[model samples]
Target: MEIEIFTLCDHAQDFNGKLVIVGTFDSISSSVYPFTHAACSLAGRLRFSEKESGVHEFKIKLIDEEGIELYPAIEGNIDVSKSVANYSTINFAINLGNLEFKKPGKYAIELYIDNEWQKGLPINVIKQ
Candidate 1:
């Protein structure tokens, strides 16, 4: 299995087999310590081999510069099966609602598949 697309966006969805993504971002500028992000979305496509079909665990983490989790990690499952013919392309839309940041520094949106780290979206919170 492999990740073809992983992004942090304002909005994303799988609309009629289309992965619609908007406002892709990698940084947040805030003037306060306890900054609140109204909403953020994780959009991506997971590609699997033809024979790979099972229920796998998918996780997301918001971590600080010190590699400490700043919030409760998001845990979920991804069902992979041969829905099509050649391969499987699973489109996912994960929304992080009302997330708060206590400090301005480096942060990341980490992706894990079956308890293994697969990808990371690096984000910087800048105080201005």
Candidate 2:
């Protein structure tokens, strides 16, 4: 399996196997110690080879710089069916709301597939 695209964005959707992403960003700026981002999305596309067909466990975590989870881990299973082509792709969009940042610092959005770490997306909360 391969990750074709992964990002944090203002909005995202999977429209008939197509990924529509908007306002991709890596940082947030606020003047207060604790800030709440009203809404956002974590979007990605995963490609699976014919040999990888079957059910795969997936998990997403949002952790602070100190390795503390900001929210409960998102877990699910993805069923990949064999296609006529060399690979089959799956698009996903996880809508997040009321993301609270406790301080100005770095955070990580980590992706795990089949109990293996796949990617880490960094985000910074900046104090203005």
Candidate 3:
């Protein structure tokens, strides 16, 4: 399972162009799983924190339909704290080759904003 997370700054408060976050996953064999959104703020403050800093937290809980976590084979996290003022776009990638994705189906991705369910990224894994 190769997962790529690309975040585009659509309607930010004071963003000019946009920001992109890309992530990849490999070796995923799970049928279903859960995912959370990556939070970002322009005020140099975290959405779940009060500390003043140019940083944001990008986190997600990967789980199966039966409420089982399938993130042991592979995992990763990236922090764009200090370099928030340089680039307008960011990319993140993760590989889940340990899990091994075998078939093709509908996967669930839950994106949250300020602790709320916003949307999901449905991925179809086909054999190549």
Q: Please tell me which predicted candidate would have the highest lDDT against the true structure.
A: 2
Find the 10 residues in a row with the least total lDDT in model 2: 64-73
Writing each residue's lDDT as its tens digit, candidate 3 over 68-119 gives 4445412233343433453323333232223333344444444443354444
- After the best TM-score superposition of candidate 2, give how far the Cα of residue 40 lies from its true spot, in angstroms: 0.5
Whose TM-score is greatest here?
2
Q: What TM-score does each of the candidates earn? A: 0.93, 0.98, 0.35
Number of clashes found in candidate 3 = 38
Descending-TM-score candidate ranking: 2, 1, 3
Q: For model 2, how does the per-residue alpha-carbon lDDT over 1-128 read when each residue is reduced to its tens digit?
A: 88999999999999998899999999999999789999999999999999999999999999999889999999999999989998999999999999999899999999999999999999999999
Clash count (model 2, backbone only): 0
Clashes of each: 0, 0, 38
Tell me which residue pairs clash in candidate 1: none
Determine which window of 10 residues in candidate 1 has minimal summed lDDT.
78-87
